[model samples]
Target: MKKPASAVPAKKRSFMEFMKRREGQRGLVIVLFMAIPLLLLAVFTYIPFLKMVQFSFFDMKYIGDRTFVGLQNYIDVFKRDDIFGALFVSVYYMGGAVVQLALALFFASLMVFKVKGDAFFKGAMFFPYLICGIAVGFIFKFFYARGFVLDSLLQLLGMEMEDIPMWLQDQRINNISLAATSVWRYTGQNMILFLGAMMSVDSDLYEAASLDGANKWHQFRYIILPSIKSIVVLNLILSISGSLSAFEPPYVITNGTMGTGTYFVIMNRLAHENQKVGLACAMAIVLLAIIILCTVAQKLFFKYVFDDGTADESKAAVRRRKMEEKAAKKAAKSGAMAQSSVSGKGGQK
Candidate 1:
């Protein structure tokens, strides 16, 4: 069934007409837009994750004969004290995340108002976040090294050198020191995120609250907190997940010694140094499960805390409601004034 030349033009015209239609254009656009990202996600994220899951079940190295050990790797992940105990180290980081979030919120709130040298302060705060994590690690390593930057500063404050405990050596304070580095590097990032969220809040709400005699604290509590709840939740989940997978500061600063071996550092060591790839994979899976559980738990906690009837509403919805209420009140007051004027005119007559 060969088509003639004229018939081929007719077919081409029909195809062009189809392409001109909205549905065809939409479908074409969707396919074009989604194809690359989906392909990349499959290739990079999903495929690798599935491969890791499969690898968790086998006894293997980076390159070697694989033995089908089934659940032995999983069992060994739990049985090994060194591997499992590393999870406790994450508690320090988690604590640091709390401090980080608090300081971020405080600074963000301050930045929302007019302040002196606002741009300079913001840049100074955010500069750490811009620095390379490895570079920041090395910087702090030297900063915290005995008789270095931090020690020199403390000594200038009339504190004896002997009175100053080793920042990265004393087991009691080394973990805290490492955790503080994480806080230093990340607090600025959290502050910037919080500031963006706060800046997006309706300014009208603040003005109205001010007219209603709401102080800064009251305005922050009732209006800002409610409006930015979603951002707060998002930050909390990310911070918690980051805490669970902390690696850089400890890895670069301390090399995971002095009771500072977090789960990721231990996993790295096992997979690379010890060549326990399967055990490392199992540990990864376990960490993934813990992170998922923590995320779910956090979502549930936030849901419960915000279980007011308006919990499902977004920040925009809250702002819209307030605007509507304000409009309605203004209309009522105008109507009352009109009625009062008519009543006075009637009495005069």
Candidate 2:
């Protein structure tokens, strides 16, 4: 006949009680909200990254017998001249990034003030960034083709046909030409970012600077730059990282030919065309390491440069503090003079 109530009912009752509580409901909601994202991240990002790292250690193709070739792939990454040469090609892109940032900052600084056709100019600049990278690559491909848009424009300036250099074919100028495409495409983006940062700065500070006889250049140097230092640093980091991973311009425009292959393009060829998946994985890992190092170095440099006596204090912070101190001293001096004048009037009375 019916045995004594088992522990199962007791446990079920407790669980139901817990579920009925607000904390339990909140925990359940949290878990439900986090589950999908965490699952997807695990499956897509973490798993793939771990698999790539694993593949880096094995000498195996996408569909081939697996063989462990510990560290040889990594060694080859440095030993191979093509892979190393791709790194050198990145230098041109890095230089282009510097120029891109300068142009972006200059335009952003100018446009932040009242300028005619500012909206149209901003849209014209940022429009390229909104376009697909592949589309941009193709557009520049035709733009750089011999006797194309660029050449036609040059020819209109009384330049002879024989003097015009090949934009994509010549080894000396091809990389520069490709890098210029990147600059043109991305400069607008940086300008927009800098503009956003500049817009956030207090207008009163600008007025104060103007009152102090600061010219446009001085305002830009002492006020705008110090205020937007964070954004400037962020843009620099992104630009440097993008430069290292530049692929679309060189890959689509030149097909990584005539010495335009970047690290990514070379890695892509190694993985797909050559079927050296393991070595490609190693190269990817190496590139990741290099990017991390560069990012850390940049952060440290900014930190050191921006830090004054106080921890993490920026130049803008220092300037603001000095202004506050000066204002306080002026107020205190005025108050003390008023008090002394009142005392003298009382004595005469």
Candidate 3:
């Protein structure tokens, strides 16, 4: 059977109409503009990510023959207790990140209400972030060294050497100290980000809330937090992933020694020092999966909890009630029909 000419041209005509639309033309232009960056991302990010995933499935050193090992590499990651123990170090970093965010939020909230020397304080706070990671590590190493900067400052505050504890030597405290360095480095950045988010919020809203007898805390809770929820959530996600992959402070200061080895540091050592590249790749893949899972979980959690899924919930509840009512009515009707049929049959009998 021959296709109708009209039908054949319909798809083409629709496409032509779409192309003729101004919105379609603008979308095409936007896509054209995005192509280069998309290509670069695919080449740089996605290609490497795929290669890492492939590497996870193989047992191969950097120089040796690659053999398919399937899940062995992944299994190896869990079999060793060190990998899990290394993850425990992330707790310290995560705790520090939370503290950093809290401090940042506190400072940003206070500073949003017009503070004296704001620029100076902002600059001072942000300066550490501007410093190179290695330089910061070196600086802190010296600062935390015995009878050095931190110790000296503490001594001036009337703490004796006997009373003071070693910052980097003690396993119990070294991870905390290292994590603090990250907090010191990142807190200002988070504060600035939060301050920016807060500033963008409608000033009129705050004024109106205040006019309605809302206090600072009330205003913050109802207005500022809601406005900056996305930013806060984003920072938290980044903080979580970054904490899990912490490497620089421990690498530069403790060199992954004294229980300061984070997941990435351990992976780094496994890959380079131990030359167990496949195992390291598997570890990396696992960590990446964990990070992705955490991010997805946070996004879904926020969407459900804060993104007002109430409409959907209410709609679902209404649908369920309607379904139940319909089923009950149907059942009652069926029962009545069956009873009438039985009575008719009996009467006939």
What TM-score would every model get versus the actual structure?
A: 0.81, 0.83, 0.77
* lDDT of each residue in 115-175, candidate 1, tens digit only: 8998898889988988987999999999999999999999999999999999998988898
> What C-alpha RMSD separates each model from the true structure?
10.7, 12.2, 14.6
* Candidate with maximal TM-score: 2
The TM-score between candidate 3 and the true structure equals: 0.77
lDDT of 2 by residue, 232-346 (tens): 8888888898999999999899999988999999999999999999999999999989999999999998876653432234568656755765676577877775445333222
Estimate the TM-score for candidate 1.
0.81
RMSD of 3: 14.6
C-alpha local distance difference test of each model? 0.84, 0.86, 0.84
Give the per-residue lDDT digits (tens) of candidate 3, residues 248-304: 999998888877889989999888899888899899889989999999999999766
Weakest lDDT window of 10 consecutive positions for candidate 2: 340-349
Candidate 1 global lDDT? 0.84
Reference-based lDDT, residue 177, model 1: 93
Q: Per model, how many backbone clashes are there?
A: 0, 0, 0
Better of 2 and 3 by TM-score: 2
